[model samples]
Target: MTPTNILSVEAYFDLICPWCLIGKRHLETALGLLARERPDVTVHVEWRSYPLIPATPPDGIPYRDFYVARLGSPQAVAVRQAQVCHAAREAGLTLALDRIETFPNTLLAHRLVRFVRRQSGAEATAALIDNLFTRYFIRAQNIGDGQVLSDALAECGVDMPGASGTPVRHDLDWLPPLNGPDDLPPRTGLGVPHFVFNGTHSVSGSRPPAALLEAMQRALARAKQIATRTAA
Candidate 1:
């Protein structure tokens, strides 16, 4: 039987952030486990856009150079990359950060995700997201480039945004639910790959699948209690 209980999950993410990809994988695993354990509950995930570095030029900048400048040295950048690579391995992803030449601005990619989600729904949009991440992180493609993004979308059976003459809005201003002047979503408190369950219980970072499962269970219990009270 279809689960009558609905668990709303709002995940704030940025395409450029590796953690977001890893978190996505973990979340999927957790959801699978959730289905087995709680067949009475259905999960709904909304991928919210949270561009981490909006100031990046549309053309983007050298990936290595950007990190070196930000981290003060190539060694520091290497250290950070190593840490991420270790975490990536844990999530069954092998990141070739060095092969990635450009740290492309994610505005266009984010816009495409929104466009695809609106037109094709969540499953197609989810596939598009995976392809985009692979194109940039694995294939070393510059995702900010329309051609790269177009190619990725094609792989997922999606067309480029605005192809049908409908204008593709690059700006994220329409998502006014984000509080404050920064890109940080109020629910997340800080950083991408943040998850909010049922608009109340929130968990930040790329947590393990078990941790996510616990949070989901708690959110379900809390929501059940609320519904019971209201019914009475």
Candidate 2:
């Protein structure tokens, strides 16, 4: 029998990015495909943090206005959203893009996810991530709002007892603790929803399942080769 090789996947993402959610779905699909094809390879995923809009106001700005300004017009925003919606549908996700109201500073939300991972476990962490994204993208709730976050925490069975309950200052200049060699080259010109396998194979953006599956196979193969060389 062939010995199984473990592949470490570090997924750097932020809750505010809808593409990240789509990437999550794609990764899950890729893992399922990988299991059938490469039973000798096992995957271990680590969800890491990457804040997209760290400068957002603590109270958050209007989502529609922000996108309109960034995209240059309401019409442009609609076109961009349509593009996202088309991609979301392909990923088996339904995103009510117009339902979103706030472009939030996601510092607290990211911290809360880290908290869940540390206290509850992987299942709880996934549940909380979905809860936050559902509330924000589907229901269009303000994730920066204390009430929204409080409800999500309760639903996820996370007990963050000592939370200050005060608003996070947007200018706090905080950064999440990063690990491994997942950083993409500057030439890539992309952010969030990045996947790194075996600390070497990395891809950015919302890749299709087949592409992701290919990366996993290549990474695992390289890992086994390195292992064989190290043992020799």
Candidate 3:
């Protein structure tokens, strides 16, 4: 049976950040395990936009050059991203850190995700987000281009129209929620991949699948108690 109470998780991340990819994979693993153990926990995930380097241009920039000029050199950025790749791999994800070509402007991608969220469900949007990250990071594809995004959306069942049509520009928005350098709630002080259990409890970061399962179980129990009390 479908759980009456839905668990909502707001993920604030940018495609350029490799940790974000790791976080997503861990979350998916947690959800899959939960589905097997407790079939009643309904999860609804929302993708929020968070730019790692907002000053970067929309046209796109060579990732190595951009990082080297800001930090040190191409080798240094590679070393850092390599750590992220290792972490992701440990969490059962494959990431190609060395082949990253450019850090494309992801504002448009975020807009496309939001548009899909409005039309499709949260699960579909999450899948699309995963695909975009993989294409850019692993396959070294130019996801900054609108044509690529449009095609990806269509492949994910979005049915987007032309490049400049409504489907492409519908969810393009400038503002994002929880405005700040850190993405979290007002009181919880959490981070990205904030798993909100029935709008109350939350777990941040790339957590273990077991921990996520436990959280879902607790949330389900609490929801049942609330319903029982209401009926009484």
Instruction: Give the number of the best model, judged by lDDT.
Output: 1
Off by over 4 Å in 3: 1-5, 69-76, 162-190, 228-232
Candidate 3, residue 102: how far the Cα is off, in Å: 0.8
lDDT tens per residue, model 3, 80-99: 77777778779877777567
Write the candidate numbers in order of decreasing lDDT: 1, 2, 3
lDDT of 1: 0.82
Runs of candidate 1 with Cα error greater than 4 angstroms are: 1-4, 160-184, 187-189
Model 2, residue 138: C-alpha shift (Å): 1.0
Q: For every model shown, what is its TM-score relative to the native structure? A: 0.87, 0.85, 0.77
Query: Largest TM-score belongs to which candidate?
Result: 1
**Candidate 2: Cα lDDT at 105:** 82
Checking candidate 2 for backbone clashes, the offending pairs are none
Report how far off residue 201 is in candidate 2 (Å): 0.3
Q: What is the C-alpha lDDT of each candidate?
A: 0.82, 0.79, 0.70
Tens digit of per-residue lDDT, candidate 1, span 81-132: 9999999999999998989999888887887787677778888988888998
Window of ten residues with lowest summed lDDT in model 2: 178-187
